[model samples]
Target: MANIKSAKKRIKVTLVRTERNKAIRSKVKTAIKKVESAVAASDKQLAQANLKNAVVEITKAASKGVYHKNNASRKVARLSKAVDSINA
Candidate 1:
């Protein structure tokens, strides 16, 4: 239990932020998984579509500071490679 009012408020704010972050991360993970599954199944069209969605989600995450820009770019590159392999 927080004894001070400020401490209590901080705890509440932290909880809210945690919940939001979790939701964003979950969405990102699901999007990534959808793309990965399509890649694994060798479905080029579906993988490309899912890859776009994944890139959008990842970029949003990066903009939100959940991930570094370099990390986001790396992930996007990997996904692009997967899509290319499908095309090849």
Candidate 2:
């Protein structure tokens, strides 16, 4: 437990930020999984749709600092590739 008031406030802030980050990451993971499932099922249109959603979620996460920009780009690239494979 934090003894000082400022330290207690910092602890509360940290908890809030942690929870927000966790939620954002969870959303990104779910988006990725949706795209992957669509790809696995060979549903081209669905994959494309889910790819857009995944990209949005990933970019949002990156912007919020939950993920690095390059990491987000890589995730988008991999998902795009998987979706493209469904077309080919």
Candidate 3:
């Protein structure tokens, strides 16, 4: 319902950005889940591997503005802690 041309363009851009953000968010969630599942299975090596991947994905998301820097840091910290606990 955007009558102005600029408004129409903005709406289109918004939709595209929304989809992109959703995909990034989904990827982040999947990565986090993988780490959690590996930890739950009590496989330290698998958990460590998944933790590395999850950290990468989270950092990328934060850099891309999908997540706040502190939020991403917190997530990585918690995941790392879980993996470390397995080793202890």
Off by over 4 Å in 3: none
Candidate 3 displacement at residue 43 in angstroms: 0.3
Candidate 1 weakest ten by summed lDDT: 79-88
Model 1, which residues run further than 4 Å from truth? none
Displacement of residue 8 (Cα, Å) in model 1 is 0.8
- Put the candidates in TM-score order, highest first: 3, 2, 1
Among all windows of 10 consecutive residues in model 3, the one with the lowest summed lDDT is 79-88
Global Cα lDDT for candidate 3: 0.95
Error of 1 at 23 (Å): 0.5
- With a 3 Å backbone cut-off (N, CA, C), the pairs that clash in candidate 2 are none
**lDDT tens readout by residue for model 1, 1-88:** 9999999999999999899889888988999899999999999989989998999999999999888999989989988998899758
What are the lDDT scores of the predictions, listed in order?
A: 0.92, 0.96, 0.95
Can you give the TM-score per candidate against the true fold? 0.92, 0.96, 0.97
Off by over 4 Å in 2: none
Instruction: Write the residue-wise lDDT of candidate 3 on 4-67 in tens digits.
Output: 9999999999999999999999999999999999999899999999999999999999999999
RMSD, one per candidate, in order: 1.1, 0.7, 0.7
